[model samples]
Target chain A: MTTSFEDFAAGQVTPLLRYATVLTGDPHLAQDVVQECLLRAQQRWARIGGLDAPGAYLKRMVTNEFLSWRRRFKVHSTLTGIDPPTPDPAGRYDERDAMLRRIARLPRKQKAAVVLRFYEGYDDAEIAAVLGCTQGTVRSHISRALSTLRAADRVKEAL
Target chain B: MNTEDLIRDALRRQADLAPPPGPVLAALHRPRRRRKPLYLVLATAGTAAVVAIAATTFSRPTADAPPAGSNRPPFSTVTGSPSPTGVPSGKLVSLEYAPTWLPDGFVEWRRSLFDHGWQRTWRQAPPDHSPSAPALTFEITRGSIGSLLESADEPANRTTVNGAPGVYTDDGLRWQVADKLVLTVNLDNVPDARGTIRRIAESVRPDRRQIRVPVSFGGSTRFTVSANSRDDWTASTDVSYRDGRYMAMLHSVAHVGSSPRTVTALGREASYEEAGGGVLTIPLAPDRFLSVGGLGLSGFQQPVPVETLTEVAALVEVDLGVDLSWLGV
Candidate 1:
């Protein structure tokens, strides 16, 4: 007999959520990604249920959702002035925040590539699998993202 | 700081950071009757089973299988032994070429084989080795390799392993290894199965180049072992079983991610597959742990081979050192 979606949820959802968090970086946003992925998987569990690695499907869904969310919001290409932080010599946390802000400023694909490769510790091929692109594309994203991070004057000053 | 290093640290910290609150399982589970289209269902179901099976199947028979393009006959010995008397004689139905063995106390449901390249065979365990394990299931087919590959989708990605290319699809992620045969060590299930699978795959790695460990009852049963492990622990081992005895032991380590203690601890919990209206969890501690037993009450086929199973369990223990926990035999 086929396993119920409820049982599948109990067995598989948390791993997806954990993965979503890595993808979106916002727990709330990750929730949306996870929810959307779940809905998609549920609508087609009969097929996914039989897959050797349903987890991979869920991952692809989450990554795609995150990318789509970015496009829908048109959040990329928006520039913000790096406000001079309140002076604190020892609070390296400010530097971290500045760096995060800079990373946040990168284009969506590049950010995803960086997050997937460095944050998730996925190899180039895994990053490609998650991103639904080729390994060369994944490398390109990483390369472009590093360039953007390097060009951010605030990041350099903080370093 | 270098961007790569910072990126690495940032990513590590991200993994450590509290994960965001995303979709809950409760929210994901939708009632049936609202399911998606038929093609999706077929596509998905077809992908899962076919991918995992293919992932394990298409590799070298053993770790020592001849390297790619070596032009050497991968088979070291023609060891296909004839079936013994009283042995179930039928089509070589389904054969799951799993390098690993099943944990003690785990019983395969004997049911009618239909599609999925499965054929029915003797339901009873070996008389002398009753309760045989690690329980493995395999099926052979007369179709072309493409027929099997088509059963599943193309692998997720392709790579070269030791100058050979291997198409791989497992769980969800798909990839191909080139150059050399690749052994997938999940490190997330029963240690015995994991170790056995690794060992079996590695045994034929060299000249044999296949992951399938061939066994045959011959004169004065002799066998070989091949292994690869980190400085701490090995991941795979191969041994020959004949005349209720183990002839050789081969061991190997796959990926070097953590220490043995970490791996041992990681291997504790049981990852289950839904079977027979219940879940089967194979524990990973104290080798030969019980998976499910006492089938006398669990509604098994008649002529319950309780005695045979027990005998197999004992033989496994004596030969393989499997610690079959008291499973209410």
Candidate 2:
């Protein structure tokens, strides 16, 4: 069945924006990236809509836009200072917020691989396809990212 | 309590940051700026002139002309010194001719559009990490075709293309197809080179078209964009100010090499350096970077401040999802 661009975009934009948000760590930039991708997709929706998995295709587009958005503009979320999460009443560190900040600081590819794996639940093959790299490269990216996060965890434990 | 579980939970929480899609959808519905009419005017003028020349040269009656549709030599060759033709004055904005036929397994793989001409290449297979791979190239230029023929190492074998005089040499076939138009076909490592070159040259037809680049700039109106190149995986553009005071180049290829320093631009860490002028390399993807180099100069030709380059980098708008397949050869 041939789906119109409007219908496809209307149905897919939310999920795409979510994925982009996690990948970019910036909701506003995520919106901009998703909108830009959707506009481009609309420009050639006649061909994209005929694909067997237009949603997946658009997801890949969102992934690529997130990957490249930094080069096009200054990405504030990644570099701008973030206030530390408020300590719980018990005075324990907010591990989740700390981890999110660390993940945001990871290199773009490593962050993308980790998000695709943990957040998107993508296997190495699928992540490789989206990242335009070999499965071995994807594994390397995820491994390096986990190492960085783990090192931070050990420092917290020692302190 | 494990790191994997912690990461997942954190990511889910971050996903909630995604805003509603209403604003984005509304932005998409807004009208876009129309492309300049200069492109249309140039395309129409170039096409009409080429069509007129092609029709006149090909339709001329000759006693020795082969019967219609039969596979025979359409024009005879004569030995003579090719005359120097006047160079065309205007910039070439559209491709005016394309090969109507190619060898059985050939597929276009690269294309470059410059101010004075465009070149396209076709290969039997992907270059596949081999720069020396065999291919065929078709080029049309309004620049000096005589210079190309003059630079040939071997003597030229004079020939005729559709009744107009041309030259055939070891490198390729060259024909002054019109007053300002020159067509050249280069065959490399192909079998039956002589026959292939002749057939390909004869099969040329008018195909006027322009490439819609994936990147656009909403910067100053004084800057005019020109000279675009694209291949299988990358594209680039050159923009220069009218008075030649400043120029900026944008490239899609990543700058993986190390730089001496980094500076904040567009709120991101960008590798900065000053070789000839200021160059900024911003990470676009793990494998790709948008390289914006500024050639700004003061009245005394001194390099301008790096801030000007930063501003130029900010003005670039990239549509990462645009299907660039059309820009390929």
Candidate 3:
């Protein structure tokens, strides 16, 4: 007997949502993606209920939903033009927090590539599988994203 | 710190900040999927069964599976060992060859057969005396090598393993053994791993096996099986079981929208919904459900009894294990 979608969700909903949360970088949105995916998964439970790695399948679903989430519900909540107080001559900004802020500001695909590659430790092929793109595309996404991040660091160090 | 390390640390901290697991689960139980109306919602773990209303004619095996080149077909080892009395049999699998030999201490780890063009994968324990992991794994996919080539992060080098024409890459050794069948060996760490890989490739011979997951349902719920996925995780299938003239056509899935009629289907709380009684939706989660739709369930000519749908759901066994290791829960 194949697993019911409910069982799969009850068992997998946590990681699936967590993966979605990080992938989307928002708790509410992660819940939305997981719910959407589970609803879709329930529709195909018969076909997918028996795969060896249903979680992998659902993760991919979450990823696709995430990409769609980006396209359909692009967040425009940037704090534009809000200049911070001048740093006291001896005061250094928290580099880690700055790096993370920049990372969060990355475009959706690049951010996804970063999270999947570095945070999740998935290889290029696996990341591509999750993001539904060619492995080469994943490489370029990472390369461009890392380059941008590195450029930011270089500018800070020069200052 | 390096960018990667920094990103990893920040992300991990953020992940740790994920609002408790119990909340995550509770939030999904809230209604939403039923309200959103959009096209193209797809994702994956092992197999993400997608449901659409397109009138797709059922094709045996997969016709869209890109044709594996004539010379090298893919490999899918039959699942499960033989019953100890008969030869190893699996569904829709034809092994062109089995290694006449394997390195000592190498044992079968797992085997998977996919029904969508039915790709196969087999892994064996690392050869004894080898330190480190990324064990030797074999993957056989049926369809176009173009998809494989397209997904490759590195370019493939045209070469032959064991005199069999194939492509070599940092990815692994890939070659199509028969028409529409491509085989690959992922050797992570071993002495002269490539050489041993080639030897193993050479030893494989055509010893095809076919096995099918048997299905049996009791009572008036009897039906034949079709359009079933062999991917092992969910084994999600599209079975249109017929009880003589009375037929029940159902596939597994989650809910979309509208209220539901609850039933104890197959010993679980099945939330059932019908649209004009043409479509039957069985809720699996808050926003997820399995739908039995099409001309059969719709009662186009005659209203399909809810009893038929319930029986069909009952016949399906939903036995599965879910892993949340990634969730850290």
lDDT of each: 0.33, 0.53, 0.44
What docking grade does candidate 1 earn? incorrect
Interface residue Cα RMSD of candidate 2 after superposition: 23.3
Ranking 1 against 3 by lDDT, winner: 3
Worst 10-residue lDDT window, candidate 3 chain B: B320-329
Which parts of model 1 are misplaced by more than 4 Å?
A1-8, A71-91, A153-155, B11-23, B29-329
lDDT value, candidate 2, whole model: 0.53
Name the top lDDT candidate: 2
Q: Model 3 TM-score?
A: 0.36
Sequence-dependent TM-score of model 1: 0.35
Classify candidate 3 by CAPRI docking class: incorrect
Model 1 Cα lDDT, one tens digit per residue, B1-329:
66566656544433322221111322332132135210000000000000000001111222333456874322222111211122211112112332233334433322112221221111122201111112222222212222223434545333322333322322111112211112222111122343443333333222222222221122212121111101111111111233221111111111110111111111233222222112211222232121111111111112212222222222111111111111111
Off by over 4 Å in 2: A72-74, A78-80, A90-93, B32-329
TM-score of each model, in listed order? 0.35, 0.38, 0.36
